[model samples]
Target chain A: MIYVKELCKTFRVARRDGGMKNTLKSFFHREYTEIHALDHLNFTIGEGEMVGYIGPNGAGKSSTVKVLSGILVPDSGICTVGGRVPWKERTAHVAQIGVVFGQRSQLWWDVPVIDTFTLLRDIYSVPETIYRRNLDELTEMLGLSQLLRTPTRQLSLGQRMRCEIAASLIHDPKILFLDEPTIGLDAVSKIAVRDFIKARNRERGTTVILTTHDMQDIEALTERILLIGRGRILRDGSLDALKREYMTERHMTVLCAGLDADTLSLPAGMTLSESHPDRAVFSLDTTVLPVSDAIAAVSAQTDIYDLSVENPSLDTLITHLYKEYEVG
Target chain B: MKQFKKVPAHRLYGTFFSMHLRAAMEYKSSFLMSFFGMTLTSLASFFAIWLLFDRFHTVDGYTLSEVLLCYSVILMGFSVSEIFLRGFDTFAGQVQSGSFDRLLLRPRSLLFSVLVSRMEFARTGRFLQGILVTAYAVTHADIVWTPARAGAYLLMLLGCCVFFSSLLILQAGVCFFTIEGLEVMNIFSHGGKELGSYPLDIYGSRPLILFFTFLVPLACAQYYPFLYLTGRADCGLYALTPLWTLAFLLVCIGVWRIGVRKYQSTGS
Candidate 1:
């Protein structure tokens, strides 16, 4: 339901040297440096697809979201959300999309959360029946019934984030753009948000484009992943495909009754990463030697008391990917 | 299937207005303090005008009531616009805080959204003061009130409101480019209200009168209409000169549109 091609946005930022004399000189002749916030970015998201947009800081993730959500006009590119150019037909295009900026709020402060919802209802021209239905459903799902009456400024951060999500969904937008929705949330709140998003995607088929630094959020909520860096899309594929490519090494931790310290010989595919009195951590290249073979090889030298083999976590794989792309 | 009925702009604005009222009511003590404070400050300015009239019985060949009439018209117009157009007055804050991005995400006119985002009901203090002064002027000024004069008076108030509102909009449009409100803009918005308190011709300068008459159109709402209202001008067309403020409104909207298209939202 979203198509973007050759999207480019450059920002001219003012620069000035420190010290009073330089400041005075620069005031008369200001200098600027152009930063490419988005550079020929291209991606297509299908309907009902929840995609994780992962990138490091200043990677143009938020810039891309702004362009698609009609908040920023790109210098040059063609972007159509559900067949409407966002910046060209903003009022019409925004009606079909919901956006939640985790760091920013859309709810009115010093007023009950419900007041903002009703204002949004009127703003989007949602039908009374639909508004009621959506409000009831969101209240139940987000556990907002108790919090709706509280002023936004009085609510805790997690409570406010839930209300922010509900406010965005009041109009039942077909597409949802969540920029770092799980940031600054406790574990329980994060899981609650992730579960609600997953359920919403499953039940209502809402297309979700989520950008978050939390790898667990990506692992739990999205099937497809779009990795961007330096204002360009570096990788775009299914999460499992990325895992398959980056998960070639398996970490093996073995607790053994070690009788020798420096006299042990290891196989070519297995390298001991860490060693202790009775425990040893091995990094095994599973492509060269399978997990079973690696375990058997370790068992030959030491009396194994306990053993565990694990694939690297998603966080490690992302860090590895970022390093591979030289984005960090 | 039930049809989704579209809410009219007026009803939506009413919703916003009532919400602002409720929000303001939350801080009753602060609201009252500011309301009275605003009244007293405006009264001080009116007191200055009263002292001037007392010292000079007729300044520029106009009676005290005539000057009071001009002052009240400008004062009432300014207060009305300040009450309703406060969003534009404080728009730089919205842009700086990135809240303006939220407005663009809604399915409504950006101008309408911004217009309803804020309202300074506290300015009703100045509005009431204007009414009191207008009442005193009407009772004391010797002028025949015909239907045309009444119409001219009503149009003058409306034109003045539009004139000030356009100035606020112009300043708000400038915020998109500069990202901060220019203090120089206050010279026109606040300064015009002070200068317009007296009839433009009383300024005794041709360029000053022409600047307000054609360039900014402040005199169109005050001077020309005041001339027709007081029977000083026989031409019926002077009464309609207040309509020129509409042209200024169009120009401001054009600038605002350009600003919106060129908007570069700050932060993520």
Candidate 2:
């Protein structure tokens, strides 16, 4: 279990002008600005639960993950993971958790991937039997049999990401913190990673806290989504709940061959978003105007060649959510 | 299932060294060139010393063999410490590249992880030169062989390693505050190496001798221990002066812990 209350963190950033003269002057008399990276953030995560943490750039997602993983101590707050204060008992806290930073590799670049795994086994002090068992399981599950003997430098991005995930799980940590695990990965590798994560959670009851800008990773893996922006938790609920609350409308695009610009009119509660000579896109409130009625109106006014309706994509919904919370 | 026992620190260090060696071997030609380059550089210094001795039979009342003995001990100590502590030497790069975060996530001592992250076996080039100088100095220097004297020499070697390693730890610790690292620290690490290669009294500066003795403990590892070895000092206290290097080490470790705390709070 993880619990955090009123978590607050701030950073001091040095400021200087562009010119050499200003740079030299600031070196003598420096100026600094305080950035509030975390502001009274609060959350509770039960065991065996998968939560997707989403935010824009500079939204404190990484900061929150760092604090939770015992890498960074918060300025003011109470954060406890499995009944131990993370920063106060870092070794003990980190022993039960595994973290993977997609942008940074923990493996030695020139060494074979298996060499890193064995070294990590020793570092984590895994039992001989448990080590072998976990290694076999991770290798088989992640399809790492072929890549283990190869050096990390030689592996493709997707192959390397698979190995990275397997490496983090060598100790069989109870809580996994994944920061952008699917970044720069191909479609097949992305699904492989997601499926592996799901299996791990199901089999081991591992609580996972993942942060990513990729909404699909969140939609595919997490039922619960925590949206944070500008150092605050803007929304916290199930992904479905957020969608239901914020995205009641649907989008429809129509292709009409002989539509008169002056006579073309959308049905009630429909707004024309884009219009061209042969294509028109309309945003319709499904609660007010059904797709069938809107299509009938357009077809009656002109000869409709084609029409398609789709629920607002998660990207659009998230953009609307960000606007609602006044977060960029 | 069998119980899990933490790998002993020594064993872990051995594993780290082996891993480093394996990585170094990947580029066999580059490794050989680096090893040869370091050997040639140190050989040039030894030749300079030999030229000086050819002109003067002794330097500051210490015979040529005695000065070579002092220089070799300092060289071995610095090179051995540099071999194992290369990670700390390049700690600023680790901080900038964010590998330091990965180290923090591991469940081991930060110092231990940092010490083992990189090992420069090329430093063995200097080690070989130092060993050769020590062998020549031992054969030519007129010192009575005694078990007690051998023990003191071993202590001196250990002290030298600690002294140099403490300097590296201090350098790494400073990175927490100033991420770019202070080049001025070279004045101590490299400067200590250059100064320690000669007798402290040769400079004829009392304040310099005092600073090395009490502050950095260079005299403790080199001069005082040498005096006992050369029979110039009969006091066992002088022989044991090298142990004082531990006090300097402890101070460095204390500073490192404070720096770690600062890093944790700042989260850089």
Candidate 3:
């Protein structure tokens, strides 16, 4: 279980102007700006829960991860993992958690992947039997058998990412914190990672807090989403709830074979997004007009061959949330 | 069901050293070239001193072999510390590259992790050269080989290692305050070796001797111990002067601890 209440963190950034004159000026008297990276955030994640932490760049996502992982001490906050303060009991807290930074390589560059894993086994003081069991299962699950013998630098990005995930889980951490875990992998690699994460959460009951820009990763792996923007928790709900709350408009696309020439007239509050001789797309706001009425109105104007109705995608839903919250 | 036990620090360090040695040996050609290159460069310094002595039989009542003893001890201390403490020497770059963040994520001591992340095996070339110089000096230097004198010599070598390691740690601690490394710290590390190559008395400067004796404690490791070994100072306490270097190591570690706390708070 994890509980964070009113956590706040601020960073002081030095300001300097360009060119020799300003650079010399800064040498004498430098300006500084205070950035509130985490401003009074409150969230609690229950055991065996998989939550996606979503935010734009500079949105304090990584800052939150660092604080939870015991890498950074916040200025003022009450954050605890199963009653232990991460920053205060760093070594013990870190031993019970796993972290994967997608942009960084935790494995040694020149050494074989197995060497890094073995080193971590000792570093974490995992029992030999548990180490062997985890190694076997992870190797088979991640398809890292042959790749383990090769140096990490030689592996492709996809293969390296798999090893990175496996490396973090060698100690069988109870809580897994993934910062952009599926950042740059190909489709297959991404699916493999997501499936593994989902399976691990289901089977092992590992508490996963993932932060990623890839919406599909959130959709595939997490049922709950926590949207953060401008150092504040903007929204927290299920994927279905987000769709229902933001899906005031429904998009209907019609594939009509022969109806043409500026003929069809849509009902009030419905707008045509795209139009062609063979196909047309219309946006309907459900609050103003019913879905049944929109269907009848479209059928009255043109001979409808094929029609499909859908809500906005996760990408559009998030964009709408960002706009509603007025966060960049 | 079982009590958790962390790996002993010494055992973990041993594993780190073995892994580093293995990694270094992976690049056989580069390792050999640098190893030989260091020995050759260090040999050049010895010849420089030898050439100066060839022209003048004694500088400040110290013969050529006596100077070699001092030079070789400093060389051994410098190279030995470099072998183990090169991690701190390169700590600033690690912090910049965010590798220091990776180090902090682990459930181990940050200082130990940094110390183990790097080990300069190539510097063995300098260490070997120092050993050779010590062998040459021991046979030639005119001194009675008392057990206390031999102990003083070994202690002086250890002191030199600790003293240089302290300098490296101090520099690393400074990196926490300024992410950009201070290159000026090298003046003390490299300059101390150069200054310690000769008898401290030859400087003929009281402030210089005192500075080395108390601040960096380089002269305590070389000069006071050398006085006892050469029978110049009859005091038994001079043989124990290298103990001061241990005190210097303690101070360095204390500063390094403060830096670690600062890093956790600042998160830079």
Candidate 4:
């Protein structure tokens, strides 16, 4: 559904120093530095795939989304979505794609959400029958039947985000480009949004390219992850592949009431430290020391109340990706 | 199963106007206040002349009625442009808020979307007052009412509307290139309305008249047409000078296209 090759975008940013004198000097003679927002970026997202596009701030994530959505024409390279170039065939290309910029709304501020949706139906030329069907489905699924009649300004952030999602889907677009959809949502709202997105992908075969700071969103929805930093696509592979590569050490905690920590039979490459009277922490190279063997060693030494092995969080892995990549 | 689908330009325009009407309805008090305020405020322009003629009895050799005819036409032209083309008038807001991006994303023409996104009903009341003032001017004027003369007045009104709208469009279009909207464009747009409220001849001719005539064609729509309407002009060609406003308008659209190209290239 999407194909991009060597997609490079450069912006000429005027360079100016701070302070009143420097600002005045800039008015007389300004210097500009060329910033490569996206450099030799390449990725292919197939139909019906929900991929999380995550990176640190100013990592060119929004730039990539803008380019793909035809909002910005790239300086170089070819980006094709559904066999049409985004910038070259914007009308036709955009007709098939839905974009929701979390910071900017597509709906009119003074009007009700439904009014904006109705206008969008006309703008997109969606058939009346199809518009009704989609509106009904999206409204009910997003729990937005009540919110539709309310003015956009009156909606809460969570409520408005739902409306934003619904607004984008009014055209029944095949591909959705969500730029930070879950940016400032509560945990419940975030999960609900994730569930709704997953359901959309499952039922309609909608292709979703989501850019977000929340790694949990990636863990929940996308099997594949695309990491970008400093205008470069550093990693592109499945989530487990990334987890295995960066997160080599696994930790386990055993909870035992009134147990001697030294009695724990530690694995060869493992060290046990008492965190609490009931809890002990052990480290193991997940590749060499199987989690079950380490757990068996602990259970043999102490009467276990409860125990669990935990993989490093997706957040930790992503933070490592950020530091390793040194996202500008 | 449908062979084809389309909304005719007239129908599209109807939809745009109705949507704006609905939007205006939502702001009932603001709409009503502005509507009343525009009518009263626009009347002040005529009162300036009414007070002047009260003192002097004439501007140059033109009487109150003749100058009223000129002011009415200019006011009518400006009010109509502002009413329908307000989207262009406030294009800076659209660009700054990024609503312009939403406009470009639609399948329809970007120009049409900008026009539809905003339509000020308040100016319609002002336009009605201007039209009424012009009608009063026509009753008092000495021109013989031939069908051709009637046609000329209607055509002149239309040509002036297009000309003013074109200026506003040209102003908005320049915002694309600069990434910032310039307020000075209003000098040509809003300022033109104020300037056209009188006989350009009173400002003296020299090269300015030639510049406004052959270049911008403001004189065509106002000065020459006013001369013909007031019996000062003898040639039939003078009656048709209002048509030059259309050509002048097309040039503005051309400039607008270049600005759009720059906007796409820079994408700032």
Model 3, position B177, has a per-residue lDDT of 89
Residue B91 error, candidate 4, Å = 1.5
True-vs-predicted CA distance for residue B92, candidate 3, Å: 0.4
Better of 1 and 2 by DockQ: 2
Task: DockQ for every model, please.
Answer: 0.62, 0.83, 0.73, 0.48
Best by lDDT: 1
Write model 4 residue lDDT over A124-171, tens digit each, in one string: 778788889999999889999899989888998888999999899998
What's the lDDT for residue B78 in model 3?
A: 95
Q: Residues A1-328, candidate 3, lDDT per residue (tens digit)?
A: 8999999998898998789999999999999999999999889999999999998888889999988999889899799996799989988888889999999888988888999998998899887888999999999999999999998889999999999999999999999999889888999999999999999999999999999989899888889999888777888889888877787888989887655547667789788898888888889999889989988988877788999998777888788888888886
Which DockQ-derived CAPRI band holds candidate 2?
high
Model 2 TM-score is 0.97
- Of candidate 3 chain B, the 10-residue stretch with the lowest lDDT total is B1-10
RMSD in order of candidates: 2.0, 1.8, 1.7, 2.6
State TM-scores per candidate.
0.96, 0.97, 0.97, 0.93
Give the CA lDDT, 0 to 100, for residue A310 in model 1.
90
The model with the greater TM-score, 1 or 3, is: 3
Candidate 2 error regions (>4 Å): A274-279, A303-305, B1-3
Using DockQ, rank the candidates from best to worst. 2, 3, 1, 4
